[model samples]
Target: MFRILLGREGRVWREALAAVLAAEEDLEVVAELAHTDEVPVVAARKRPDVVVLDHALPGSLTVPDLCEKLGAALPGSVVLVLMDQRGGALSTALARLAPRVGVLTTDATPWQLVESVRQLVRGETVLDAKVAVAALTARDNPLTDRERDVLRLAADGAPAKEIATELFLSAGTVRNYLSRVIAKTGARTRIEAIRIAQASGWI
Candidate 1:
């Protein structure tokens, strides 16, 4: 059987999708997670052959970090991410992961989702055409991965000290990161930086 791990927030949709994938004769739903924080832990333990993840799965870690963590934990596994938007930090991150990563909009039919998983296992890159085009044409995100991480926390209204505690960095380092984020976004203040990043879909 082709083992599958699923990570998505909505209980109804998650369970329904699990049922569909599980119905396949050669596919099995080995694990499911509603939060991004649990994904790395469960995925590491389960070692599934494929991971079907939702881009907006709620948790502390950003989508990029979650994807990076997944890649590190299961380098050989394929990740099929269900996304809403076509381009941004999330798509950029997924693109960097290349053939091991597959993306489809949340509106993708269940049949498309199933076929994409099989294609991924067969070593074919699967990307929605519009998603691929937007990812390629979208302006590159100016912030590095670390900058984006710090900015995501800041966007959540976390103070530098709290951000430091969460990220295991010193308060001063967090402030520096915030400063760089502000400068990179060309914002005169922290709040403005947060707004700019959000509007640009960088965070």
Candidate 2:
């Protein structure tokens, strides 16, 4: 039998998911967690075969960072992250977990979750088709490479002169780049432009 742990926050939602997984004759629900901090203690004690976690949690921390630690705590157990959207706020960095971590969107049926748990136990990567399509269909970044570079620094509150020094450009040129970036991002100020780009996953 495959021992499973539910690491989502909501009681009702966790129970609902538990009911779905319980139907699998080969899968067993061993524990449930409402917080990321509880994962290490429970996984160490239960040593479950799989962990089903929701990408959104109560704390300011992200589930991806928690996944790294959970994977390390139980080397034998693999993580399956459920995304609420076609593609969650998943950083481009999530590609690193492609081998041992699985990602499924919220629209997934109960059977898909069950099968994904079995597949993870078998050591397979499970990624939703919507994830692929979302990546492909994302709005293209409108900023030029240099503009992106400048905006990256500007986003961190660096002034034009400081940014110019870092990129080895003239201070006047850096200001010009910031102006163009603000216009392209359709923001009234450099700060607003940086915010827009960051929100869009461009920076």
Q: Taking the tens digit of each residue's C-alpha lDDT, what string does model 2 give over 1-203?
A: 98898988789999999989988899899998887667778889999888888865433235667778877878888888887443323633344687578888778999899998888888887888876555455466787756777876787788889888877789999999999998898999888998887667565
Clashing pairs in 1: none
Count of backbone collisions within predicted model 2: 0
The residue-by-residue lDDT of candidate 1 on 140-179, one tens digit each, is 6898767877877787788989888877789999999999
lDDT by candidate, in order shown: 0.83, 0.77
Prediction 2 global C-alpha lDDT: 0.77
lDDT of 1 at 171: 95
Per-residue error (Å), model 2, residue 195: 11
Cα shift from native, residue 177, model 1 (Å): 2.9
TM-score of each: 0.74, 0.66
- Model 1 earns a TM-score of 0.74
Off by over 4 Å in 2: 86-91, 136-203
What TM value does model 2 have? 0.66
